[model samples]
Target: MTDTALSLNTIQVGANARVGDYLALLKPRVMSLVVFTGFAGLFVAPGTLHPLLAAVAVLCIAIGAGAAGAINMWYDRDIDAIMERTRRRPIPSGLIEPAEALAFGVTLSLFYVMLMGLAVNWTAAGLLALANGFYVFVYTIWLKRRTPQNIVIGGAAGAFPPMIGWAAVSGTVELESIALFLIIFMWTPPHFWALALYRAGDYAAAGVPMLPVVAGPEVTRRQIVFYSAILAPLAMTPVVLGFAGWLYAVIAGLLGLAFIALAVQVWRETGERAARRLFGFSILYLFVLFSALIAEQALAPRFAGLPGTGLGLWG
Candidate 1:
């Protein structure tokens, strides 16, 4: 959306830019989580895809996520340079030129979408495109600096992978997929807000309007608790909705309780420690919930009807 094409300024980096630099541009750590969630969606969907196609679909999701990350770094380079936490990023650190990152993102985005359409299904490709567009155009360009609700709306971009995964296998977006979507959607606010709570100065310095920076930590803490409460119930809906099994229900309940407990600490305590604890746990919370889904959908079915062998909403 910002004219990245004309922002190329070459810097002296003969040996500084390596494979790792490019990979960092893609945000590999974040990409891994996106790929896992998308794979979980494909796994839990009612139907199946050939293993090769399944792998391709997951690969596309990863590339698309990386592409979006690269574009984000390119667009936010200026603010990134200002923020202490992000000041060393490739674009901001001058490891990779903004134009190069932009080109890499655009090329990867197009390549993955076209590859997905040809190798998997058009539905999944379309979803991938939508996620990329929303992250780049809507979140980065339009909402991030302008609103405190950026994470609330931008979070939707991260929520689409599982739906894309489900579409890859079922060729449709089903209620079960919607459940996965909601889980992430509700989880995003508290997760990012926790980080924002501790990094308020960085956001403020970068001129980004994070909730913590704009509304004050007290308000941010209350908002985090509010979202965490809603998220607990929303997370368990999949179990009641009959897509996930009872094992997921038990785990979801426990994790939700734990999440709320942490949120309460965040609300009661007034410091970075509580917020950091919640932030770390929130990542683990999401990974475990989705991983449980993968286990329930993929592994437990083989041991169905056996005592203590299966856990899920459906056998």
Candidate 2:
């Protein structure tokens, strides 16, 4: 165990934990992406829902994701204090005590799960709750410190939102929702590895077993390209599965190819710049992919009714 871990109870916490500190625990910036993806999944699922109810479901997912983030910050405070990238986080910076952050996270997590079950469907709520538990126990407590493959397995927590959103409408999961889950699951390694490549020093200093810290940079770069190759082709599955249309296919194709190209650049290069660009582009790539789904769901209906358009499979 580390010194911080050994002396956790002895650490002095900041006296005044402000509103901003509480919000910081939630990792609000990442929460925005979760909200958008969750909403898109619910919106595009083939079912009718009252707009108010749909809003509630999205809110539950956002809160659940944020709650998970808070717990992650709480548990990882020991290492966070060592990493430059995370040293200033709420718990690590001493702005919030670990006990308080853990309690806050647990409270919000239970409330969000209950609200989702009451307002939407139990399946969605179950998925929401499961995401948080899995993130904290499987990812944070176990894999994060133990293995280089932490993000690969832990990424499942982040991928669950879209599926939970799909369940909010359909009340059950389907092959289509699984496809969305896989898209994000595969995207995570390359996306996270890109950042890890550039932030190797942080991981090394923090004693976190991120790929770049455990595996050589060359291996990490290769893995990024390897995952990107799989993600590119897999991104088109929604079209084939009947949930998306040609517009989505076209957009996914372009973006997928561009993603592969960026991955290749990262693989060939020996510096942080390419890795940094891939990290930034990965965020845009995922956002555009989901947005394309929204666009196709809205516009694909117009062309589907016309025969031979080859747009919407269900239409």
Candidate 3:
């Protein structure tokens, strides 16, 4: 092949690589949970938003989450390169430039927050902006490398979605929305510590002060049980608050128990597998708990007469 033609082909391949790499910077797996929880908040809120506007609200949340993830990848590229789990990420893998990722993240963050303010209520937009800022500044920059309590406080960023979702419809933050926020906030420590327990070596190598890396695995395991114990009851806050019904109560109770069971096993077992299991189950537990709330809310109109349907405990 001619040298010019070969050069052109190489350029094309590089361009193609960037396309996918940019998306990877957004951390789509994490974005999915943000979207689901945000939607759940919107779905269960007391008032109604136009379907089109509702879509916009959810889209804004998703984009805001993605924007934060991109910025996180940009900021953490150094430690990400060192950590085994994140070594192949876009910036660390050299598929994308840090400057480009930062620009992309900042652009999306501004765009989504503005779009939310214009399309939805400013309350929701403000919360979205707060979430993005907290994730980028508080969690990624300040906390991640500084303290073992990183995820404990940083988890607040992830917890904002439901509150934002509620504000989208209600035009104000409510006690029920705060209950949703607390669920994820409390769940985050146990969920992340489980992974940290198993990946303590990677955290230490990266100089990230994850719980297990700073304290021993035994301490991490104990902390996990402690957080899980709190989370089990926190998950039921919706039912107690009268926003969710017995359906949600029962499912959340079961899931919370299972979550505690897994945490206990992580504490007792001397194997990484136990930690891994807790990590995996923690994801399922949150997903199912939120899913139960969505289901109960969605079915409430149709099953109004049924037990544990429309009225909730107080209604």
Give per-model CA RMSD.
Answer: 5.9, 6.5, 3.9
Q: What TM-score against the true fold does each predicted structure earn?
A: 0.91, 0.92, 0.92
The candidate that wins on TM-score is: 3
Off by over 4 Å in 2: 1-14, 302-315
**Deviation in Å, model 1, residue 16 alpha carbon:** 3.4
For all candidates in order, the CA lDDT equals 0.88, 0.88, 0.88
Which whole-number lDDT from 0 to 100 does residue 168 have in model 1?
Answer: 89
lDDT of 2 by residue, 1-315 (tens): 888776774554655677999999999988988898888788678766677778899999998999999999988899889888888898877788899999999999999999999998899999998899989999999999999999999999999988998898889988888999999999999999999999999998888889988988999999999999999999988878777778888999999999999999999999899999999999999999999987767676555321111112322
The C-alpha local distance difference test score for the whole of candidate 1 amounts to: 0.88
Writing each residue's lDDT as its tens digit, candidate 3 over 209-303 gives 99888888999899999999999898877877778778888898899888889999999998999999988998888788889888877777344
Which 10-residue window in model 1 sums to the lowest lDDT? 305-314
